[model samples]
Target: MAAIDEQIEQVERRFGVQLPEDYRLFLRSRTGMSQFVPPADDYLMLDSADELIDINEAGEFQERFPGSLVIGGDGARELLTYDFRQSPPPLVLLDTAASDWSAAIPQAPSLTVFLDQFPETGWIWGGDSR
Candidate 1:
């Protein structure tokens, strides 16, 4: 956790933004690459929310849920599903950073985690948003 905090501090310094509470929690939970964007055919436990259908599938994950704040649609699942047992998106953490980074991107007013917001097969911010 200290390492994460250190990294967070570094990010804050670099971006001059303060992360939000929910976003901070999500970052602290998974300081590395999130476990939801890969393999394209397995149902992996995403976050503390609910199981999010795999976006790798027919791309229905984004269709069902659009303009969502959270990004959950990878892992090994076939369909997009929200996982309530995993952490939220890294963007959430950036939003919680209480720094300039938040100002540089979108945010969830209520921290309502969503699945479609995440890219099904791509990269964002060095894949941080993936």
Candidate 2:
């Protein structure tokens, strides 16, 4: 696993934007995990630092949303992103087909709150099958 500082630097350099403190801390604690389910059934699993960078660098989403950094996805067409233009970086869900970022749904104010509210196993609270 990459050191937290190294990961932070790599992310900022590649994405051309600074990561929020909470998200940085989250990466420090959990650099990456495999096969973990998300709270939302419609969304895909959260990706590791390397995987996320790869997804963004592929230029598929970046070409559409230039400043948006994709942090997660639904494994289909939708993506969960951090809008770098906003202070503290609010999480937004983007639909790839329509490229309708103007209707982006705000998921959380910061990564810390996002994780705290929707933990790895948070789906259990709603009795959703994993």
Give the clash count for each candidate. Answer: 42, 0
Work out candidate 2's RMSD over C-alphas: 5.6
* Poorest 10 consecutive residues by lDDT, candidate 1: 48-57
Model 2 over residues 18-119: C-alpha lDDT tens digits? Answer: 887777766777755434444443334566766667878764777777789888765666666898877767877677664646757666677666666654
C-alpha displacement of 126 in model 1, angstroms?
24
lDDT of each: 0.35, 0.67
TM-score of 2: 0.73
Name the lDDT value of residue 127 in candidate 2: 19
Give the residue spans of candidate 2 off by over 4 A. Answer: 33-44, 119-130
Tell me the spans in candidate 1 whose CA falls farther than 4 Å from its real position.
32-107, 110-112, 115-130
Per lDDT, the best of the predicted structures is 2
**Residue 36 accuracy (lDDT) in model 2:** 41
